[model samples]
Target chain A: MLKLLTFVKNCKEGVLRATPKKPRETRRKKILQTALEILPQRGFDGITLESIADALGYTKPAIYYYFKNKDDLVCSLVTDYLKDAHQAICAITDGNGSPKERLIRIIHFYVDRNCEQRGYFTIDHHLGGVLRKMPHTAEADNLRKLSLEIPSRLIKLINEGIQLGEFRDEDPAVLGSLIFSLLGGVLTHMEMPSLASLGVEGLKQRVCDFALKGIVV
Target chain B: MLKLLTFVKNCKEGVLRATPKKPRETRRKKILQTALEILPQRGFDGITLESIADALGYTKPAIYYYFKNKDDLVCSLVTDYLKDAHQAICAITDGNGSPKERLIRIIHFYVDRNCEQRGYFTIDHHLGGVLRKMPHTAEADNLRKLSLEIPSRLIKLINEGIQLGEFRDEDPAVLGSLIFSLLGGVLTHMEMPSLASLGVEGLKQRVCDFALKGIVV
Candidate 1:
């Protein structure tokens, strides 16, 4: 009876701790989502801090509390996106097989997962423009560095496959670019309104199939 | 005296014919060159025909003399660029080779030629937004269709490769997308001022090296 009472009290305390944190997370996520959709249309050069806050019906002070400045807000949005994307890229070759098998798995993972995280790509679209035109603070550089790491992992795996003689001997760097081009092409068409109506899954599958043809022996 | 008179008459006629035509062609070429540079930075919505004419100290009417409208000017500028790009693409295939060799040649031609055509890419930047927001006019539709053809050719090559037992069988459409994405990843990086300083040739070489590893047998 004494232990049961302690367990009940602990469970109630846990709920109290989780409830406040959940809404804060929810609010931050909501801000990121809205920012992604709006900024791409107006462009980062054209967007203002007040505009973002007003669009969300939040006070300037509230946003100021989350992000010290507009740049901070933009960097945080992209950094969060890259971390998620980086994970998905690593997930591509997690299965076991010949190097060829591993690469095929990676291609599907890249396509299907990118299909799910389509929103993440807009962050990349704006990333170069922002970094090039805007000043490079630590946050901007960090975001840029983290973003490139996504492809670096895929390169690492292909390098490994080459060492194992699974892939044909060639410049690993060039192969990575060819594959990267393939991904860009697929994404471009997928995003087009003319092409988007074909359905995301169908397009994703086609992209995966294309990626495999180029890499598989 | 008669021979001297005849020589002067012939010279006068030749000078009259050459003078007007040469300046007209020179002015038209000058306008096109300035438009390519300015259009990329200001965007189609941001720039005006007046601005283009002013850049060269030509009258707005002079620009009109060469071009019927903004649409006509844009189309005329792109027509030559598209013709060159199409020729470069055609040069990629060897008529007969292993699937891998043919694909590699195609990849090589693209990277080499695309590097040279960075100026042309700038013109296409604002087009995505224009196409999305505007109705499907013939000019817009034509550009859109032309854009898709590059990848379609790549897809066809992949299909041929599979049929020849030179490549692992895979969907041609998907292969087209992957190569394009790989190209985009490289091209996007080149737009960065800091990285643009790295020179497109270097970037293309590295990106192509990395991409080939993932795709080549």
Candidate 2:
């Protein structure tokens, strides 16, 4: 009975510790959310650990425990995004479909993701300026590679489409860049009330249709 | 004989003053050119009076004599471009031609100008980030108005096209934005060697074709 009681007490303690750990995870998520909110307005240099902590009703030490500093925090935020984007791109590109279908799906995925993460992109636009200044840093270099990969993946898709004779015989590299540019231009306009009025699906369809007509066989 | 000598001396003085003024004008142009060269690489904050002076082999006070300050220099550069853009837009919008033709001409003008001024757009991209931060400043507000006018002019042209039954019955505002987005996307790509390899006329033709197909009935 004594052995059984000791085992039961240990199990209960483990469960109690697990419960508190989840709240810390929740707090970390909340910190990232608050950081995203401030980034679009103030940019990277403008944000500080204290500002994030103050927004979350926590102390600076509390944030430091979660994120080493602003650089680590921003790296976490950006890498997390890039990971998700890479996964989405892979799923769409690797899926079984015609080149046209795959290309359309890729565009849709980008449009949908941007729409879903509307405010996050505003932060990204601000972060771009910060990144350009520190282009030689490892994190900035990684970001550049990731950004270039997006267009490169599209180029592959376009090349596949061309070989399959689904798309017109245009330079895949140029077309990929053009599509990337189109997506970027539309996303920038999304912040405008007039364009946002088109809503998500409506705008996606328009963009896809425009892109399709440009290169469809 | 005294009257003749006085006339000759006055003519000599006038010629000497004119000769110095020509060099002053040339120097002012050189300063603007050097500033444009540095802007794309360094952004607005990264640039300083000392840096511009260093690039041009002049003293800061010399630069100050040409431009009151950094803000004055940038304002002058941007306003000069805007002034030229405004005049070109007005000529295209008000000139006699089919709405479709006028629109294509405008797109070509923009593409050509951007291709011709490739490095300049890089500076513009950086300036955009700076403007976003101080969006309510007088210069920023003026830039906002000028930017809006570009799209607004397109909307008018599209409206006329729809009335003439040249374009499909779509929202003129939406179509204008779409064209604007397409133009923006293509202009950005003009700087990349891969895209610039498409050459000015080739890239302009592709942009025109894509835009025309999107709206043509």
Candidate 3:
């Protein structure tokens, strides 16, 4: 426990120290953080780098030092979020267990990660139509590409299960896409009458059960 | 052949003449037809009575003769769309085919319906805010209700299949939601990059193969 606590304290110090360590880097991080937080509140069409800089108590040039433009800042936020998701999904999948157990844990982590970062959905995902001619356009495309990879890995598990005759045959690529839907279906109810009618735990179970039912031998 | 040809002409004439036949009613149908054509290009925010009227060579008051207000018009659209969807889904589900086949056909219809009516997804769909305190919000709320009903119906199908010993024992509701995701997964690829990769016919076949692989006996 002492060692774990020591390690955590060091980690926190490393993260804090990593920030504001360099003048240009600090401004970049600040700009990206501001974009990540504010994009959800105002739709993408309404956001400007000037507004983001003003919100952070910085000059436009200060932000320009960190990001080339508004889309660049958004691309960075999207990229960072994708990297975090990829790492989380990878950690869950790397564990040694039956695919069923692994997937349950992954689904649980997936939902928790979503709730933990619900703000990103509103910010980075509104309309999802970033303007062309931005330098980070390729990177933004890659972030979405990364988003697709997590499900691909999950589908790979289902494919393996089928090969072992422990699960029924299913198209893994399509199965991966469906898992994404099950994962996000509750968002469909956000505007409905009962906000709390279908709880998160219940929604997750629905996804897990849906996945297993189609495949169990 | 003569009788069949007459039946076809009669059906077409009936659709055209089933209208309220009132001069005022023509304005309403004209408005809705215009809205369907233009709204997808411009989103909910992009539509207004004046714009629709301009497109139809009428004045705002002329359009209002049919709809009370913008809200009334939207509610009418929602009601009409849902009625059509319910009818389309019901036709497949009325004991005409096997459970697996019915599920596939219905799921295909749901996905295809969206492709044809991309207007529903053009905006953020923030109805919680849109419907708040509005008198006609019930129409939009019903759309939300249908989201749940859709999965519930699928669960019923899975339960029937399992009881008939066609599928393995698994939770039905969960499976139903999964089936939704399998089809719902198409939303992620609406933009040009992904959209171009998935040509129209390519997606239809993908949905078919995906559904059968998951549920085939």
Residue-level lDDT for B180 in candidate 2 = 74
Q: Which stretches of candidate 3 lie over 4 Å from their true place?
A: A1-41, A46-69, A91-95, A123-128, A131-158, A187-202, B1-24, B48-72, B82-112, B120-129, B133-217
* Candidate 3, residue B214: lDDT: 55
Point to the candidate with the largest TM-score.
Answer: 2
DockQ of each: 0.25, 0.48, 0.16
What DockQ results for candidate 2?
0.48
Range of the 10 consecutive residues with the lowest summed lDDT in candidate 1 chain B:
B208-217
- The digit string of per-residue lDDT tens for model 1 on A24-50 reads 788878877778767655666666668
State TM-scores per candidate.
Answer: 0.64, 0.80, 0.60
Residue lDDT tens for model 2, B60-86: 998897888887777777767766777
TM-score of chain A considered alone, across all candidate predictions = 0.73, 0.80, 0.69
Where is model 3 chain B poorest over a 10-residue stretch in terms of lDDT? B122-131
Candidates by lDDT, descending order:
2, 1, 3
Listed per prediction, chain B TM-scores read 0.72, 0.80, 0.70
Query: Which tens-of-lDDT digit does each residue in A68-167 have in candidate 3?
Result: 8766676677667768767977887777877777778877776665555555555424424542333465665676668677667777777876687776
Candidate 3 clashing pairs, residues 3+ apart or interchain: A210-B174
Residue A38's lDDT in candidate 3: 73
Tens-digit lDDT track for model 3 on B76-174? Answer: 665566567667766766657677778778766766766776655432243334444346456566766654454566677778878887655666654
> DockQ score of candidate 1?
0.25
- In terms of docking quality, model 2 is acceptable
